[model samples]
Target: MEYNEFITHVQTLTQSDSREEAERATLAILKTINELVPDEEMQEIAVQLPQKLGEILREKETKSNQSFNLQEFIERASQKENIKPTTTAIHARAVFSVLQSSITPDVFTKFHKYFSHDYEELFFTSP
Candidate 1:
């Protein structure tokens, strides 16, 4: 799903009348983000994401009809953290790593297709 859709889902899942539920939802989102990004990248990105996501949820709560500003969120996240803004590349690597570490060889062929040329280009271009 797109970030906007994912955020909407998260917001819905998180908005409980209770503070405890909200906290739990935040933790779940953080876990998902950690699982999705490289471990090294997580610390930097995590510093900014929870607050950003909370802002998004707050906006949705106050202005029920307003459309979510997903592009702005992405732009802000990348700029604030000095991280690459490509979700596909990040998620592809995360899923590939998870499959590699846990799944059997029979599933490798299915998971392998998710790997992207962007990562290869990134690897080659790095100093």
Candidate 2:
């Protein structure tokens, strides 16, 4: 999706009040995800992302790399954005939903392999 479409979808999904809020949440979610997936895969995904979003992911390329499961992923994104884990989970699921639609299903599955099956709900909002 284009950047505008991306932001609009995020705002709709998150019920964000303003453009800034949506941008912050989207960038935070992307950056947090950048820290999780491997460098090579991140590069591949970045190519499919918008210019600014791609740059955000690339900026994390040389930063510290972290490996986290589903809960820790939500916790870290929450801490990074200074939000609650429950709230972060919602934002993250929105991001993942966008990614699932934007990226090839094969590559999206590859990214999820980084997490465990417990994250399935975060993927498709399963019960």
Q: Give the TM-score of candidate 1.
A: 0.28
Instruction: Give the Cα RMSD of candidate 1.
Output: 15.4
Model 1 residue runs over 4 Å out of place are 1-14, 49-127
Off by over 4 Å in 2: 61-65, 125-127
> What clash count goes with each model?
0, 0
Per-residue C-alpha lDDT of model 1 across residues 55-122, encoded as one tens digit per residue: 43333112222222334333333443344556423332332333233334434333233334433421
**Candidate 2: TM-score?**
0.87
lDDT of 2 at 42: 85
Q: Pick the candidate with the highest lDDT.
A: 2
| lDDT value for model 2 | 0.79
Q: Write the per-residue lDDT of candidate 2 for residues 18-110, one digit (tens) a residue.
A: 877778778878878887777888887888888878788777643534766788878878877787888888888788888777878788778
Please list the C-alpha lDDT of all candidates, in the order they appear. 0.35, 0.79
- Worst ten-residue run, lDDT, model 1? 59-68
